[model samples]
Target: MKSATQDKRVFTEQETSHYIGMSRSFLRQSRMEGLRKNRTQAPPFIKIGRAVRYLKEDLDQWLDSHRKMHQLPHEGGAHV
Candidate 1:
């Protein structure tokens, strides 16, 4: 048996942003863009009525899916 505090893994928008080193706007834009493009790599979030939350596992998977290889110096200009 776990306490409510111990079982809680869902993160608020701000917390998620802080954890991922992104802004809330960045997360929101990513989510919206994914939906518009029908992409599955977007961070999966839960909407409980008007309240939104993100699961740690989902965020982690999303980060993993977006991983990229290192580029040589001046290989390419950073985008986003």
Candidate 2:
């Protein structure tokens, strides 16, 4: 069986928030902030008429782009 996320190529704001583990308000705020800054602060999205949609591929890429493989050293110089 396919998950709901896997079944859709595009998602609404609410579905996108659930899929990406972010709050709807945060996503909305990001878009607004991005617009003010003339840059994107959130995952790429599509705007159709008065609706917004996020592509599954863009979401996956966005998550991957934020990946951190190396751990930063602590201020105390301890691994923990």
Candidate 3:
């Protein structure tokens, strides 16, 4: 059994931003852009009426999808 906090499946925008290390405004802007573009620009979210919520699993997946490997110095840039 898990505690309520530990079992939380939905999070508010602010909580998602903090959990993902992004600013609230950034998330907001992304959502706005997504609306105008008719595409999702940020992590998947749920719209519960006027509130936006993010799932922990979705956030984790989004972060994983965005993972990048750092380029070795010799692998990029100067050929000299």
Which candidate number would show the highest lDDT if scored against the true structure?
2
lDDT at position 26, candidate 1: 78
Per residue, candidate 1 scores C-alpha lDDT tens digits across 5-77 of 3355898888888777788987888777776545344478999998889998887877887787885577467
Superposition TM-score, candidate 2 onto the true structure: 0.79
- In candidate 2 the C-alpha lDDT for residue 19 amounts to 89
User: Which residue pairs collide in model 2, if any?
Assistant: none
Which residue runs does candidate 2 get wrong by more than 4 Å? 35-40, 74-80
lDDT score, residue 9, model 3? 84
Candidate 3 C-alpha lDDT tens digits along 8-78: 78988878887888989889888777745564469888898999999999998998987878764674568
Top candidate on TM-score is: 2
Stretches of candidate 1 off by over 4 Å are 1-8, 36-41, 70-80
- The predicted structure with the larger TM-score, 1 or 2, is 2
Instruction: Rank candidates by TM-score, best first.
Output: 2, 3, 1
Query: What does the lDDT read for residue 13 in candidate 2?
Result: 97
Worst 10 residues of 3 by lDDT: 32-41
The residue-by-residue lDDT of candidate 2 on 16-53, one tens digit each, is: 99988999998999987775555447889999999999
* Residue 58 Cα positional deviation in candidate 3, in Å, after optimal superposition: 0.5
lDDT of 1 at 76: 64
